[model samples]
Target: MKKLFIAAILFVSSSCIKVIDPESNYITGDQLASSADALAGMVRAIPVRLVNYQNDDAGIEQCSYHGMLSMLEMMTTDMVVSGYGGFNTTSAYTYGNLSARGSNRGIYPFYMYYGYIKAVNDVIGLIDSETDDTTLKHYLGIAKAYRALFYMQVGAIYEYKAPTDSRYTEYYVAPEHDLTELTVPIVTETTTGLDVKNNPRATFDTLYEFILSDLKNAETLLADYTPSSKVYPSLAVVYGLYARAYMEMASHKNATENYMQALNYAQLAITTSGCSFLTEDQWLDPKTGFNDMTSQNSWMLACSISEGNTDGQGGGFHHTMLFGTETTYSSYGWRVGRSLNRKTYEAISDNDFRKLSWLGPDFFATETHYDDEAGKWAYTLRSADDTYVGNYRLTSDPQWLRNRITVANGFLAMPWIYPGIKFRCYAGNYTSRYPGCATDLPIMRVEEMHFIKAEAQYHLKQEEEARSTLKEIMNHRITDSSYTCIASGENLLDEIMLQKRVEFWGEGINFFDAKRLGLGVDRGWQGIGYSRYQGTYDIDGIAFFWTIPFPTAEEDGNPALQGYNNPYMYNTAMFTYQSNAALSQYYGIPPSYGN
Candidate 1:
C-alpha cells in the first residue's frame, strides 16, 4: 500500500481551530462521520505509528507478518538479533530519539502525529461548540476513547519511566508550573545535539490519568450510546482500552472487570453489530478476510487495507524487523521476514490449525491445502513461498502454482518448500512484493478478555470461576476432555500471563506485562536467545523492568519531559525488587540507577 508521507504535520493550533472541514463553512449531523481523514488523524492514530517505531514485541507472530521490522528503530534484523556492543546501540541498529516534534524525513511523522492530535482536538472542540444540541454523543465518546488510547500507547513505548505518580520529578513528561514564565520548551543540556525532543514522553501516572478522564467522560456519553460508531472505536473498543490501561497499572481486578466488558461488546459486535473472526480459509489469503476488519471477530484493528490498494501497506515496518531464517530469496536475498522460534512453533498441537500456518519440518512441494475439494478449519495456512499450495486460489494451470495432494488417509496436506513462513501479506496493488502485508493493528481481542477474566477470578480466589473462564477460552482450541489446566498460585497467574503473551504475540503487550506482574524480562535459563537492545551489557542476567537507565547517566542522554513519575524513582542503593509500597505512591529517583 502507498503510505501517506507528507513533509510536515501541523501541531495543534493555539489560536485558529482548523476543524475537520473548516473549509466546508457549514455544520451537519454527519460532520464527524463524513470526514474519515479527520477522525483518523486524532490522537488515537499516533500510537499505531509509534508502536511500529518501538520494537518491543519482535519474537512474536504479528511482526513476522508485517509492522514488526522497523516500526520505530532504524536497525536491521541482524543488528537487532545481536546487539552492537557499546554504551549506545551499535551502528547495526537504527533509531536515534526522533521524539522531538519536527521534520527531517524519518522523524517528520512525529510532527504529523501532533497534527493528527490537533485534528482530534478540532472535532472535540466542534462538539463542544455546537449550539444545535444535535449531539453526536456516540461519536464524541468514541473520539475520547481513541484519544486516550493513542496517548496510552505513546506513554508506554516512548516515555522512559511509567508515570506511576505525575508529581514524581523523575518523570519524562509532566505538567509543571512554568515557574517564572510561560514555557519556552526545556531540553536542559542532558539531551543536546540529538535534536530529539525532551519533556514530551507521557509518564504512566499522567498517561493513565489522561486515559481515565477520557474513559469516564466516554462512559457518560456511551451509556445510552450504541455500537454503530466508526469501525475504529466503539463501546467494546473503549472497554478494550480500559482493559489495556488496567493491565498496565497491575490492577488485575479492574483489568478483569473491563476485559469482560470488552468481550461482551465484541460478542455484541459479532452477533448483532456485524464483526466476527475470519474463517480458516481466510488465513494468509488476504483477499477474503485479512483486511476486512469490520467482520465480527475483529476486537480491534489498526485499519483495514486490501491487496493492491494504496491504503493496504503495512507501513514500512515489515521490511525492517522480520528477517527470515537463512532462507533463499529471489534477489534482495533473504533480508526480511525472519523465522519463528521452533519452540514457539512447536507449542501448537497438530489439531491447532493456526500452528500449521507457519512452515514445519516435513518439506514437500510448496502447497499446504488441497484444491480438488473444499476445505474447512479454524486455521488457514500462510505461504512462506508465495504460492497458494492448498488449492486456495483457483489457478488456470496446475503445475504453475503448488497444489495440495490428497493422501490415502484422506487428509490433504499443503506441500512446503521453505523451512520458514512469512505471516505478512504482500501489498498487492501497492507493492507487488509482500502480498501478506496486512495494515490493521490489533490492540485487543476476545481471547484477551478470557485471560483477563481468568486472572481476575484467580485473584479473587474464585477458583471455579477462574477455571471456567480459562476453559471457556481454551475449549475452542483444545477439546480433549482430559487436557489438564495448570492455574493456581503463581501457576494460575503465570498461565494467565502466558496466555496473554501468546494471544497477543505481535500486538505489543509483553514488555509491559512483565513489569506490571513483576516478572522481569529475563527468563534466565528458560530464555537462551540474545537481545539486540542488550548491547554487551548483562541483559540476560539483570531483571529488566520498564526501568530506562537514567538518561543523564546513559551516554545517549535523557530527553526532558513534562511531568514527574507518578510513583517517584528511587536511588540505585534503594532499589528493591520487592516493595510493599503502592506503585502510585513511590516517586523518588534512586541516586544510583545507572546502567
Candidate 2:
C-alpha cells in the first residue's frame, strides 16, 4: 500500500511539492485571480482535502488526516489498542517499529501532509498577494492557516536535534546513533521541482519562523472574516494555531519568550472564541456525545462525518474509539477495542465525572451502584447461550460497559477491562442499532485552550494563576464542589498534564505532549496498565521511538534527505523489557484470565 501510494506520488512528479494531478488541466493564475467562485471553491477544498478525503486503496480506515495521525499518535503513548480489532494493524507503533519507513502507517502522514500542502500551495500561488479583494485575502488567510497547521504537525513528528546540541542534552538522553536536527523541507507557492530536488530539511528555527509568518498573515487577513461552520478557520482558530506553534517551539528551543507567546495566544483564543466548556450533561450525552459539533459550543474547530462519506470499513475514529455502537468493530466480544492505561485510570479521582468514561476493572461488581432508571446500562444478561450476548442497546446515559455479566456459565464473558466510552457513536434514535459512522470529530475545543493556558502559566512562573486555571477546568470536570488544585511547583505542572491527559484521552494530542515534556514510556514496570504487545517494555529517559522517521519514499526521491534521514532505532534495543513477572500479574488482572 505504501509503495503504491509512493509510486503514485512519484508518478505525478519527482518532487513532493508537485503532488497535484498533472493529467488534469489546472486553472491558470489569471483565471483564479478573476474568478471568485473558483477561488472560493479551492479555499473550501483545503480542509476537506486534508480531513475528509478518502483513500480506500491504503487498506486502512485511518486514511484521512485526523484518523491516520490520531491512530499513529495514540499508539505511541499509553493508549491501548485491542488485538481483536482492525486497529491491530497499527500495533507496529506499540512494538517500537517507529522506523518502519516502508510500512503504510509510517508513510501515510508524510504522503497525506505533503499532498495537502501541495494543494494549499496551488491556491496560494494562484492568488495575488497584493490584491485589494477582501474575500481573496480571506481565502489566502485560510489557506495559509491550514498550511501552518500542517507544517506544525510535520515539524512536531519529524524534527530532531543532535546530542551535541545543548538543548537536546537538556531534555533527552544521547542516542547510541548520531543524529542531526532536521525538519521537513519547506515547500511553498513558488517552490519549483528543481528547488525541491535539492531541498534539505529545514532547521527548527527556520521551520517555526515560516510557520509563525504564515499565522501572522492569517491573523491580519481574517481580522474581519467570520466562518459559518466550525470546519473553517476563524480568528480564534488562528490564535489557537499560534498557541500550538509557539508551544511546540518552546518545547524544542526551551525559550521562555516562546512560552510567553504561547501563553498570550492561548489567553487570546479563550477570550475571543466565546466558546464555553462542555457541560457535564453535554460531555456525557449518550446520544450526541462528542459526535454533534453543531450542538456543542465547546468545539472551536471540527470535521463533520456524514454517512457514505466516512473513511469507514471499521477503520475511522468512531469505529475504533466508540465501542457502544453495535455496528462498529469494538462492540464484538473478541475485539479489545480502545482501552485506558490502568495507571492513568487509577489516577483519576473516583468522583471525577471523566472517570465514568472508562469501564472499571470491577465494573461487574459495581453494576448496582449506577442508577438503572436512567437507562445507564446498555445491555443485560439474558441467558448463558442467549443470541443477544454481544448485542448492545443505546440508553439515555449508558456507562462504558455494555453488559452486566462477568462470567456467562463457563465462559469468561467480559473482554476489555477499561475500554473507553468517552467518544460515543452518533445516536439520532436512541434505540437504533445502525448508528453508522457519522460522528463529527473535534479538531480543537476551547477546553484545550484552558489547558494550554494553565501549562503556559505554570512555565511562566505564574503559579497562583496556573493553579486557578487548573482549578477552573477541574471544577468543571470533577463533580466535587470542594476540590481544588493545591499541588505546587513541578507537581502542579504534573497535575496540569495529568488532567490534560485525562481530558484528551484517545484524542491524539498526548504523544506531542509527552515528547515536548521529555517524558518516557514506562509501561513495563510492575503494576503497569498496558495490555498485549506494549505491556512488556519501557523506554527510560526519552522514548525516541516517538520520533518518526521520514518515509523511505521521501528519502529515496529527495537527494538532500539521503544519509540525513532520522535514524532507524528499531534494531537498537532502544526499548527494553524490565519486568520478569507474569503478564497477567504485570497488568494487575486476575490469574483466571490466562495469558
Candidate 3:
C-alpha cells in the first residue's frame, strides 16, 4: 500500500507538469508551477484525499477520515453502542485491540493523516513563497493551514505522555507501567525513502513548534483572501487553528502564555468569522440539522458531502450516526447503532435544549411484545388508541419531538435505549431504502471558539470573565432565563468542560479534550451504558491504549522506529475493571437487551 501510494504521488506529479511537447505527452514541473488553476486544483484535492480517500488494503470501504477515524474516536469516549449482533464484537468495545499494530484502527489513522500531509506537501513544494501571484499565495495559505491541522490531529493521537508527568499528576494516578515521550516521524516534500528509514520520533516541543509555524505562515498569507465557501480555510479559520493549537499546548506546557494566546485567537475567530450561534430552530431542524453546512451560519469549516460522492453503503458518518433514517447501518437491525452514555445524558439539565439531542428515558417506558418464534422481546411504543406509533413525547410540543426523533419502522422493534437522534439524514430522507449519507461534517465552528475562550479565561484567573463567556453560550442553548453559572475556582473549570462536552458530543472532539486534560475513563459506574462483555474499566490519565502504537508496517520498513515504537499496550492491563457480575448487577442492562 505504501509503495502504491508513492507511485500514485509520482503519477500525480508527472501528470501535473507542463506538456512542452503535445505529441510526447510529457510535462515539466516549471510549467505546472506557473498555473494558478493547477495550484487551486491541488489545494482542493487535499480535503477529498483527507476525508474520502478509500484504502482497499484495509478490507473495509470505511477506511477514510470521516468514515472511520471520527467514528472510532467517538467510540473511545462516552458514546455507547448497543451490544447486540456485531456491535459488541468490534474493537470500539474492546479498546485493548486498538493497540495491536496490525489493527486497522491504528493503520487507518496513521495512513490517513500522513497521506494527507504528503499531498499537502506536494502543493506546498510547488509554490514559490516570494511570487507576486496572489492566487498562488491564497492556495499556499490553505495548504499550510490544512497541513497544520493534520499534524495537530496525528500528533495528539500518536504521542505518549506518562501519567506520572508533573502536568498530569493532579488528574491521574500514575499507571504501573511508564512509556517514553514521543510523536510520529516528520515527513516533508523533500524527504526521501532513505530519510524516512532513519527518521526518529519528534519531541512534543518540536511538534508544537512546527504546528505553530505553519499556522503563523497561514495567518499572514490568508490576510486578504476571502473564502467563497466554508469548505476552504479563511482568516477566521486560521485564527481558530491558532486558538486550537495554543489550547492544546497549554494542556501541558507554559500554561499562562499559551492560554492567553488561545483566548485572544478564539475571540478573534468569534468576532471576525461573520458567523453566529445556531438558534434552536437551526440546531434541531429535522431535515437539515447538522447535515447542511449552508443551513446555519455557525459552521466555519466543513467537508461537503454530496450525493454519490461519499460512501453511502454503511461506511459514512451518516450511515453510522443517523438511526432515524432507514437503510442506514444504525437502522438495519440496529447492528451498529449508538446511544448516549447514561451518565453523560443524565448530567445534562432538563432546561438545556441540548438535552433533547437524545431520546429521553420516557421513550423507553413502553410495552414490550414477545416474539415467541424468534425468542426475543420487541419493544414498541403505542398511542392512546393502542396503535403502534413508535413515538413518545418528552415536551408539551408534540411536533417538536416528532420532527427530531422519528424512527424507522424496522427500528421500532429494536431494544436500543437512548439512541441519539442529533445527526439526521439529508432532506428528511428517512423512508428511502437507499443510503442518504450526504451530510456535511463540521471541522470547525464558532461555537467551539466560545468554549475555548471560556476555558482559556478560566485558566488565566479571569474567573468572572470566564463565567460570562460560559453563560453567553449557555444562554443561547438554555431557553430557561433562570440558568446561571455561579461556580468558582475548580468548579468553574468543571462547568466549562461539562458544557463543552455536551456541546460537542459525538463530534470526535471529546477524546482529544479528555486526553489533553488527563481525564480518566470511568464508564464502569451505575447508570452507564458500556457492555458487560467489554467489561467496564477505569483507566488512569493518558490511557496507554489511547496512545496508538506505530503500525507494524512502518516499524518494519523504518529501521529507526523498530526499537523506539510506542509501548505495546495490548498485553499490559493499564486499567482496573469491575467483575461482570458486579457490572451487570449495578447497570441492570442485559448484554443483548430484550434478547
By TM-score, who's the top model here?
3
Ranking by lDDT: 3, 2, 1
Model 2 residue 385 lDDT score: 35
- Give the per-residue lDDT digits (tens) of candidate 1, residues 430-475: 2243444433444455555556667757766777777777766665
Report the Cα lDDT for candidate 2. Answer: 0.64
lDDT of 1: 0.38
TM for every model, in the order presented, reads: 0.56, 0.82, 0.83
Candidate 2 residue pairs that clash: none
Count backbone overlaps in model 3: 2
Error of 2 at 410 (Å): 16
* Candidate scoring better on TM-score of 1 and 3: 3
lDDT, candidate 2, at 11: 19
| Residue 116, model 3: Cα distance from true site in angstroms | 1.1
Q: Show pairs that collide, candidate 3.
A: 18-27, 18-28
- Winning candidate number (lDDT): 3
